[model samples]
Target chain A: MVYSISIFVSETQSAMKFGGKIGIVGAGALGAFYGARLYRAGNDVHFLVRTGFELIREHGYEIRSCDGDFTIKPPVYSAPEDLGKCDLILVGLKAFANHFLPEVLGPLATPNTVVVTLQNGLGNEETIAEALVKCGVHRSVAEASKQIIGGTAFLCSNRVAPNVIIHSAHGFVRLAEFQGSPKERTFAVAQLFLDAGISCEVRESLAAIRWEKLVWNIPFNGLGVAAHQADTAVILADPELRTTAVEIMKEVIAAAKVNGVDLDERLVADLIGKTEIMGHYKSSMQIDFEAGRPLEVEAILGEPVRRAQQKGFSAPRMHMLYALVRRMDQLRQSNLENSQSRSS
Target chain B: MVYSISIFVSETQSAMKFGGKIGIVGAGALGAFYGARLYRAGNDVHFLVRTGFELIREHGYEIRSCDGDFTIKPPVYSAPEDLGKCDLILVGLKAFANHFLPEVLGPLATPNTVVVTLQNGLGNEETIAEALVKCGVHRSVAEASKQIIGGTAFLCSNRVAPNVIIHSAHGFVRLAEFQGSPKERTFAVAQLFLDAGISCEVRESLAAIRWEKLVWNIPFNGLGVAAHQADTAVILADPELRTTAVEIMKEVIAAAKVNGVDLDERLVADLIGKTEIMGHYKSSMQIDFEAGRPLEVEAILGEPVRRAQQKGFSAPRMHMLYALVRRMDQLRQSNLENSQSRSS
Candidate 1:
């Protein structure tokens, strides 16, 4: 498994003692939030931004957070060549954007830099592992996988404006070694977030962490779009839907168990009960699809369904949702293309 | 089971030869199409229309069929007290609108009336059955069920105008005796359609027929809405969606087996192959949802999923789709209400 890492690169070498030189790639909501936190924590943090670079540079990042409000102006770049080498790289991009990583990481990533993934779904680690060997940055995938850290962000924040992010609820993470045990660097990374008033814990197994997070994502994200942008409260309120959500969560837990991760059934009840209080919160996938952006269908839905099927345990709900989302995404793309052609 | 009877009252009861006085209740697409066919065959057919009663009474019915085009100017009535009793009633309303059966069937339906439901999904027969008993027109539900005919329309048609209906493809039906074996009335009804260019056959049991039709309806209807108004051709064209559809069909068959209906797996393949040539045809449920009308969630999806669960078989796919469609329907309704309030 590859980690969806979102590391921060500090400019001052003296501040590197906390977590070393970090490269923050895919600086979307998650990357920007965490990177901003690290930057404000006396570390030399830099951001590799694609969009809103000018706005962020001019106004800085304003975090209207649930905990407290803060702002930080970090170094920003578009090209990876400008960043040089780093001690660690953190990727907070969406799984759908993982395809463009070769261009983003080819020149910037080195043989020694540790990569951590903070994206949703399965196969990100493997994707990064393969991309590493493909780019000749690393000689072998196994060696590259060893340098990766698995991350699960339990944060709820959105970039409300070009230079502003709003952290609504949670701002915590569960970090782990990617296909390996927790290392000294993992503890060091957790300490950095802990020092910044954010909760971070280093778990032993990456697969367990990934599948556990999927317990919420698979049902919520998939159902949100399928239900025509229904929110968490709406889903919890409807009896049939509420039952269906639980069923899908159970299927995810079953798949995790098959993959050697034992999850308690109580976890489902607890998650559902807690989410009931979430009000009308639209999921990330629902938000993306509604905004006419590409969804992370493969990593979030397809891979999990495929993995379960490979183990001879058919997750009917996940497979059905996967197919629906895939087809919807195709239609959206085709419709967009037609409109673009007409405009052209 | 209550039948959704769509019967037409002939003006001249003395001229009841081909099929006797018929009352066409819920004269939407299926009811209007078949009622027109019967009326053309010299039956005393009268329609009880609600929404388009004035338009249909003035212009009659124009059936633009793939087989051929035809027109009929039938007697129309709004109130059941106006139509009197009929020998046979053919129902063509959606399952969601089955609640209005008491108003439609009270005075027009007699104890001797043969109620044939041409609606989709399960429990329509029961709803109609209970409505008959509640009307005090019948003593028992079982007795009322005996007077009901279970019919599955294989035809594809749409009401393009208030009075014009376009029959695009198939014009056939599988007629069955509800809660009873094939009766003489069933054969007579079959012959009536067979005489006219439309194909009709008498099947043994209503439950078997309903479940068989569901083999196609469940997968297509559920996935179509879930996939954001995807049509038949789009579903068949996508390999993933096609596979998921087949799986759902198989689950329907399994649920049917628990209820003593034996359906072959070859049915799924046959339906898929036949539907592959359907082009971009929207399902009735999809059309209802797009038009802001209620879906047949209880009869089509919820009841089926619940039945399967009761039989100790978990249909995860159907359950998930049920939850999704249910949630989507609720959202649409709420959105409609919000829009109406804003406009007001």
Candidate 2:
């Protein structure tokens, strides 16, 4: 099994010299933004869209970027069966929609397919691995895990309308293999993004990068919504909230340390200082909340908190935020259901 | 000075046997309900009205209570000067409106006036005392504190309209002297509520009762607003939120203990159990948030958290709640001001 996995990883790495067939599983703001770039870079990229399938199929995808504008008329699929097998599958779905992974990836993933999840928070890679196993794409969790790569996309983009993505700033991505250190396939995937003009890097520790990203996400994203739809600037403007954001960051750093991922204490200050110049960036969670969409509470907060707690570390602020945001999401879901039922 | 206060306390106690001139400052829902009862009981009660001055004066005040309905055409004063001096002043103002305290109570309070603040959260008595000093009704903070009594009204009431109060249930009040142990003046004020056929009790330790009430308010009221306008039942219904509520209660209890008020740890369970039966009780803060009115964030949350922190104890959940709610209040206020200016 190890020999076959190593062989497949090397083959994937060598194949990265050419623009291999790639599948964009989510095709939302993040998916479409990155996927469009890849298609423009001459990859045979296919998008599996749900809501904007017809709009995207008819009008294609338009990227109104701060870096540069681009358009892609790639093939779009509404279902996994039509997406076809690909050498690389990039999952950019919101963590909340992750439950649909098994069905979505059932036909799209193959034994040699390298799956990269650039979703927020923890557990997306694990979910993808499980989905691969469940969908019979891989024989076991171990086999699936080797083919899975976890990524943190530090991108600021928004899908204002169907088939139209506005890329505001920062499209850097960090990639790492789920099972071990950055493998040959991980570098290959990073190369794909790098070739597409994205600032890409490969990390030895997936947990380290995920925790580092969470050091920013858990506080800013959580507080952005939890603080009554406050943006980054609004949070930084209030001294108490700024202190709270720092406290939350410290808690995340501590949680990361307990989980064997040593994050620098200065990362808190660094992230805050960087965010200070971001000029009122409404976090993705906050945006979802304002749009009355489901938040990635479990993935961004719940999973991290649970992971830390399993190792006997108490993150009171994170726990409080997770509970509050989870409740808010649950309330939003129920409210949406009620309104839908009333209208129907 | 001590002898004079002792003499005044006794005189105040004796004067409680008669109606005596009573001033009801901040005649909102709580003030209107209790003031109407005092008026109905034949006390010389005068209400200091603001927004509802004309409505209350023309139609009188109506109390639709679960206990019983009552109406009173007591004299209503739009300004404090018109309210005149009083033997006892019952303050029911929202803690946010406390800045107007010195101005509002300036003419209504005399050196002989016994002030009882039936407001939520900590620092109300201290605020009252400060207002008395600021208004020149008292020579010093010590004198003001001696005359000020703190009370927590466990009332389920709402002012549905101007001069119309709907009392759902629970009108019991717990009173204590702000300066020392419950003196004659404390019992005298308790008697005033008891005379109006309300459940009222006087306690020895002012801090003890105040902290005890906070054991409920800090969690239910804070979460009631912070958890996206969730009520008591909604908090108890979700297990995570229910757990968060308990954690907040524990923090409050610990805070109280460090501050020299050892609340029984079982108060956590007791309060949660009681809240389970409250049947969707919207806390005063939640109600205020829903109405887009100014929240008593500083009084209910900010002060208690600061008090605990001063004692070198950390209440992470309370601090987070305080920051979130305070930010929400600030955001709401700014939005309101913008709309008002735009309209103007």
Candidate 3:
């Protein structure tokens, strides 16, 4: 597993620096944005898109923002098999898509291929790390046991268009050793991202950053969704809710600190402020609410609070807000069910 | 003010038994229940009602519960002046109406009338007591209020039909003297209620009961409104939330203890359980939520928390919950205004 990961890492570094074939799996906002940027910088970028977004080639993606608009025609494919192996594969999607990712990424797994994940939240590394352990397999086992390279992508924001992702904001995208030591190839991959005008940080401590981001995401997103508000500002505008948000953030920080991140108040506050300035960024929470989707309540709100308690952190505010949001979500679900039953 | 209250007490005692007219202000649920029980037991009853409840006069007030329905008719007056002087007045309405209660109960007051309040939540006694002091009115206030009076009309559930109050669930009513001594007249009043089939308890320490009730109330009612859930059970159903509720109650109870009323944990739990059993009963907070009215957030959630904090009782749960519900109320108001503006 380690040998394969290193081989993949070397290829990523080579491809990123030398500007070779780069595949972006899950070409949604983050994927599309980074892919567009790399393509704009004169690198060959390919997108593995789902059926719904396959028409991106027909209608160009447009990113509406205060910043200047830029669009690009990165090659798009439905599956990795359609494009064969690439030097580096970037995975950008929601955490829930882990089950399908390995299969979707199968064709990109040459001996010298590396998968970089830019997905948010915790556990992506473990998923990818485990998949790499099962990399080589017989055809019968390959159907279920073939492993995929794990990658992490971190983007500021992307456009929601067909052909182009209007890159509005830029942030450092860190791809670390998902489960092994960073090789010379990893450093090259980081430099390649820089050469492509994408700020890339090769992290020795990727898990810490991922967990830190997750900590803030859970509270703010859950709060935004529960209140049916836009973002942190909508919640923070009220002093009490603001306090609650801070409290929740503190709990998250504590969880990370317990998990060995040692994030202080200042860093958490800065991250929170950054999130707010992403300006009208609706959290996945608000997105779910608007879509009437069953919220990621348990994972986003319950799990952290539960962990915090287990770690002996008195996360009073998180507990209260989590309960409040969970109950609200439950009510929303039951209300919908009632409405459906009545309509039926 | 003290002199007047004493004079009213003397007059009520002089009038004796079922002779003097009893005025029931805000003859909605509590008034209807209490008034009907008294009227049924042969006391002359008069009700002060607002517009739109004329139907109450014809069908009488009905209290429907598993226990059976009981109804009684007494004269109903829309305006305060329409009713003559009464020996006793029962103020049974929402706490928000306490501010304007003086206007409603003014005409019904004689020099020797005792005003018994059966309203829910904190500060009702203080409001009535302050009003009596300010107006230099002769009206005795009770520190403890009774849910039992409404219960005893055996009309656990009541619908006012015409001039009568129909009660369904007959239960015991608890009453106690204010901080001062329990006068002979207070006991006499208790006897009158008992004679009317309402089981009554005379509490030597009304403050403790009130504080105990307040501790239990802050968590359930505040959480119910903030969480937008129905009952105390919803708060308790989630173990984390229940622990939070208990923590909040402990703080409030500690504050109350500081204020001279020590409430044990068992009592708080019992009160919470009772509120749970009163299923589908929207708290004053929920009622305010539905009615688009300003909540008694201060009295119900804030004051206790504030007092607790002042008393060095760390009620983080209560404080946080208070802030959330207050914000929710404000946002709801803003939403109302925005919608109204759009409509206009």
Candidate 4:
């Protein structure tokens, strides 16, 4: 299958790359995998980590990948402030962790620094913008939006251990200029990713891109998290779930249209077809839930549902998914609280 | 609130009560609770048990209910053959356990015996009828449905220990003459329940009765299993989930309409209001899923959804629910299998 990866960096523009200092806000699987890749491509990458900081600092990070194994000894820190100002700041934290953005994003970005948020779902760019303004980093939401880029990764990577990442299959992303005009810096960031052996696409249609990604994410990720043991194959294999998935996609297309976004409706078929042959793939939401971590419920499901509702439209499937996934998150939180109280 | 339990025993027949043999099939919480109630009321009750057969046979069953505490040394049987024939056979097994009915129901019921199925969700009557016909205990489905009675229990009971039942609050059921006129036998069964101090109402609108019970069941019971930690109160408490519960109730009402059953649509608010004050109720489906027992997915969810679909109507919420809950059941079964294999 030919992937329309927008445009690759031309030979001339490759030399024009700045190889900017990149600060990764959340050094989970996505951060470590992509950060290590960029670092291997000779970019100065800094990872802001917490739990595995000591292990990473001592032994560095390792990647067991489908693209052959590799390791990188990039700069690692326990706080974003320690990383100083960065030319490009990538936020890979779970959406539940957005409340910590004031502390994370403020010290990591200058006015000129471009922030690429790789978080899933909608309103993330708006969230980062709000955080920037709240922290007095950016005076206005518009300026924050201008300084931000939206990234939707197709990477299949997991932080197996303290300082180890397993890259299974996909390793690429589609980048957009958040809500601003496509500028030279956007392509420069794309070029950095391209240099890391990960396909990068800079699309002018950020809303279309996000909604397109949501076409797949809303049904698969939302249902995967809501269900007990549903992976990609299980979802596709089950007739009822598959039908519900198609209906959700159609509703998503309708929601996008009602929200004044012109997403290619055919993306539904493309996604369904792609997923039909895809093997048993556990969604990130499922993984987060299984690991007892908070899910990206708001960013992925709730925001989109609310967005459609705001525009005088309704997506029942998405709305149900939002409520259910949110409930699941609540249950997990309550369990954690109960356990902690008992232990204490 | 006062309950109106219709008197099936007329003034002339009040003194002609037949304290006949009553067989309690699948002596789970519901069966045990009501059986003990009847036995306490001076009726001959027999329990068909599995695990705690010897315990129940010796110590009998105990009920710790809100009404009062009681114990009864009623007869207990490991198999239906030992119980012989009964005048009234109440099948309170989980819907998934209906497969054992040909063996269980055959030996326990005579042609004159009225079978009251106190199972949740839809299609219990149909399943019992099919099992009876398959075992040659009945001539046809019509005869089987005639011998069977539809029961919707509003009871809150749980078998906490061997030979012990915890009846939390509610202990009432709406009984209907399945596939027949309001015969004297149906009211006699209701009278029996009323005699046991359990509220019993004989409703002519069998469809309306099931649909009304489904107003609460479809949302709370359905969502209870689909979600991670949703009890009745938790579902009623969350605004998003509350909205979803209402939507599902609406769909159930609509499905009933499609099936030529006129249910009061206002029952949605009534059930929600009741559930809001239900004080952290766990649904039977949720219980079954948690206990690693197979869920009544087909009878409880799939049948109703398909019934609506058969009439050229679509129940999106029900379909989504059926898929998710079924997935939860699948996950549970798989987990059990995995654990069993590992232990082996």
Candidate 5:
């Protein structure tokens, strides 16, 4: 029975659609990479960017990937209201930026539009849910057909230029239905991602997978913040920090288990090892730290520990690290804010 | 039974002589304070000083205390051999300096002499023992007659002129016998301290008291090092820092319990509160940090936690703080060392 079902699934995947209109909000490196890929594959990809990033869109959408380089002059939208409704909207802004997703992307998310949140941490789906509710939207069978899916929370190394997003790491994009049964529309969106030359893994256990990504993130991202060190490989090289990272990873695992998402520790460790193979790549949190932007501390560090504590699980080490990192972030923020205040 | 012992103790205390010539190694603020106190009370005192301090001693010892000003011209000895045999010697130096206590103070002690170590932390008594054995001193006591004791560890607000010490705060001297037994000789030493107008307490539970003192020291001293904050009151007044201090205190308490010294949570909190009340006080660690002097990391902070861990105690917070503070200290030391090397 299992063999027959597997064969049937393979045949169905091969026959899926490969191209459609792809709308990307927060058109930075990650957004540009996904948008430009679909555009190059003959899809109508539109990028919605802010004033800071609009300069890049003026030239064109350019992607410098390790595999290949591609450039395209896809239609670019500067604001949510400026763009018309599309088949799918990929939310690629920072996890901290998720709070404003509904305000920025709501105008373009029609009843037929399926929004894919490819952001970090535990709250992407919940943040979108709350935002949708604030936008006066309900999740019915009709709305479910045009729903917001919990998109890939995996690693990606990409950066934006005047006309290109250099993609160094070709990480997979996993897609899944966040609520209820998988509709035909869910499969269509996954098919569209595959058509864009992005590997799409549709899994029934999306929570477990998203949580597994979090297990990798809490430690590596935190290790970077704690040491004020940049890359994942550098952190792993320091024995003191590496042990701390493992402890934090175990904390995330315990939290995930409490939240009903079981993950294989060895598999997570193996996945983490792959990042070391990359040439001097940093976690997004590290990048945020250097950029002097607010970090995803709440979702990535605090929320999971809170969840664990809610289930009466003690995570002293993770909590202490969280406090230290939060203080560090605050220290940086206060310095920036103070300097700005003085200048103004 | 307690009443009968108290009556006998009072009568025995009256006739006790400090027994032994007084020897002070280091002859710094602590050494000057205690040695001058003993000498003024009419006991023969000899100070082992460096070349720099030896010249300063010619001006005479000055001790400015809240009680009154005390000054005296005591005999000064440079090398350990220059000093004749003394019945009792006080090791009055920082924990780091105690490493050389053997070469410096070894020759000054007679066969019957007792070295009372009024130093901080665990395993210091052992350092003295090793120093004695290395000096080829044979005593009837299996362990070296180096009875380790805790100091009042007080503040001297006023500096005695000519390189002598002053008393900033009116705190008492806390000393103890290694075997928790009251020697008629220990009582005599306590009397000399009393005669000098310095309050002294002979404790039976010295180990427990020292650990309690550490529970106080680690939080304030560690934070002082971490934040580079100068005053204890200022650090404690900060709500965030106060919270961090409390967490550190709990870790120390746990460490103490692991080392077979049981300190309750209330006692730990009380000790923390006492530091806050002591207002405007600088920790020894903070003083070392500011002066570019080597910090007593292992003896004061590291060894206690290390010993606790050896006894199977988990001091996660303390262990983390110790690593960070040690890193900071090492980083500073390396920077200074490199700069000096480059300059030369």
Candidate 6:
């Protein structure tokens, strides 16, 4: 059951020992859950809020967790300028809103600041690297990417209300340096989550972990929405859809291999086997679709398909899924706009 | 803009002159429209009704056509046994309902009866041929195949009420013999439609015309349902979906080629162009999905994908669409059953 990837576990005893000003950007369920853990561990943590700024500032966050319930009224800022510079920045913005990264990170990032992106999908780290360069925090994308750590979260959480988060299950985080192998800071970041009682690991290849996550994400998340807001159980219940999911997983594995990140084909069976026991888990993409929010189509699907196609490898199923999900998102958005206009 | 297929214009002055007892099975919109036309043209057309048996038998069929409006009080039979043997049978059932063909056609079909399936997608003729064999009318499937002629209808019609049909536009039919090249009977069938004031032509190859229709149906119908009940306008409006439709069309064309039915590549552009001017056409599959009816996923998508794969060719996009549409149909049917059980 153990992954072949290298894992670095920091020998540090306390998250507070790593005295760094941590800035939490895009503090939704994933961001707030991890940030609250770090803040509770007595690390200096600040959160940048948007829609629920006033409510969160007045009432703070209520974390209803399966592990244990806790509340943290940590320092919250409405703007990046107010949040100030930090030694570490955690980016959890939806990939669709990644364009605001430069402006948001400009004031919060310094040359020495380590940016950790636990965002889903393929291109967040690259986007962060480009954002850093654009914001004049780094000389080049290479320099910016060096300071960035790409991580994937295996957490089941939802921001039910503006300032309320429900953490139901897994909270495992895998970290890898964006440039190459895990660096000292990568282990430090993994240690932060581990010290906060969250299962954590550091891998050698960012692409490996990302692609591994994608093996699960691409099919489950993609089909979850594309198959009319079907959950994991619904998908697995249908033999054809189950086979389709496996096919999509294989395509992803092949895509990763062609793009220089070799993933085990057994990951398909492993993920499916895990999902079968997971009950009727609605994928985040499916939830977002049901909630009428913009999907992370480009990051999760479009980028991977484009990358694979650039390598002269065709992933037709993935491409088809990308098209369906993207079109669905566009139609939903247009409908929302039309409704708003009509109401106005 | 002329099709290269041979046109068979009967030298007869009236459809009544070449009179044959015609049985219209599956008297849906398409069936009723064509049958009413033939009945009005002084041909003996009997309709086999299901859900609307009482209403249709009482009020007869009211045709509201773009061409012209008419009403016919033709003989309506509730069962095939009551309808008896026919000289010709016009099948306008949905492809998913083909399983009922054996029982339905058992009494209506004789060895001399020519069954023309105007149903959507591939395998309808095969189903009819097998049905004839199973019904003990034809000794063997090969022998039965000769009596089954496959026709693809280019019709825009909907049954608004049980006894009301709205034919918006287009009623051209392309007929081809199921066994091989067009026989004299195929031309006679085309003449039957032409005599009823409908545009009709006979093609040499059934596979060619069927695949040509699929070049339009597979993409438009499949995507129509798959893209969240999106109509043609919604699909064509979205650039990504439009491209996906074209890609699916190309895949269908390729599949047809691999299966020894060579469709022109230009059909892709031609279909898209025609669809552009066709307004917001809600494909039959999309409508069926909206109405919670079973989709023709197997016939329209699954059969073609299987045929192509049997020839060592992969139609990944089509396969993916097939999987999605099938899953959606299953979920919907299950939901309907659950609700019915609860209500009862």
Ten contiguous residues minimizing lDDT sum, candidate 1 chain A: A7-16
Error of 5 at A101 (Å): 3.4
Residue B137 deviation, candidate 5, in Å? 3.6
DockQ computed for model 5 against the true two-chain complex using alpha carbons: 0.28
- Specify the highest-DockQ model's number: 6
Quality of candidate 4's docking, in CAPRI categories?
medium
Best by lDDT: 6
Q: Write the per-residue lDDT of candidate 3 for residues B243-270, one digit (tens) a residue.
A: 7777777677677877777556676666
Model 6, residue A82: C-alpha shift (Å) = 2.7
Clashes of 6: 0
DockQ, each predicted model: 0.70, 0.68, 0.44, 0.66, 0.28, 0.72
Candidate with better DockQ, 1 vs 3: 1
Residues B121-210, candidate 5, lDDT per residue (tens digit)? 666777777777777674434556435444444444433344656677764566666765666766776677777767776665667667
lDDT of 4 by residue, A1-344 (tens): 23233555565554557567889888889988888888898888899998888889988889999999988888899977788899888888888899999888888877888889888899888989999888788899888778889989988888889799999888888888887666777788888888788988788767877887888899988888887658899898888899989989988988988877776667777888888777898888999889999989999899999999999886778899999989888888989999999999
- Error at A42, model 5, angstroms: 3.4
- Runs with alpha carbons beyond 4 Å of true place in candidate 2: A1-19, A54-59, B1-19
lDDT of each candidate versus the true structure: 0.83, 0.86, 0.64, 0.84, 0.69, 0.89
- How do the candidates rank by TM-score, highest first? 6, 1, 2, 4, 5, 3
Q: Model 1, residue A297: what's the lDDT?
A: 95
Residue lDDT tens for model 1, A1-344? 12233333222312334556778988877888898898898887778888888888888889998888998888887778887677778899899998888777787788878888999999999999888888889889998888888889988988777678888999888888896777667777777777777887778788988999999999899878777666788788888878878988999999988888888888898889779888898899988989899999999999998889888888888888788888878888999999999999
Per-residue error at B249 for model 2, in Å? 0.8
* Model 4 pairs whose backbones collide: none
Please give the lDDT score for candidate 3.
0.64
| Regions of candidate 6 where Cα sits further than 4 Å from its true position | A1-3, A10-17, A51-60, A133-142, B1-18, B54-59
TM-score of candidate 1's chain B against its reference?
0.93
lDDT tens per residue, model 2, A1-344: 11011112333463546357899988889999999999998889999989978888998998999998888789999888888898889999999999899999999988988888999999988889889999999888988988888888989999999899999999998887888787656777877787888888777788988998999999999998888878999899999999999999999989998999887787777787799999989999999999998999999999999999999987889999999999889988899899999999
Pull out the clashing pairs in model 2.
none
Cα RMSD over interface residues, candidate 3: 2.1
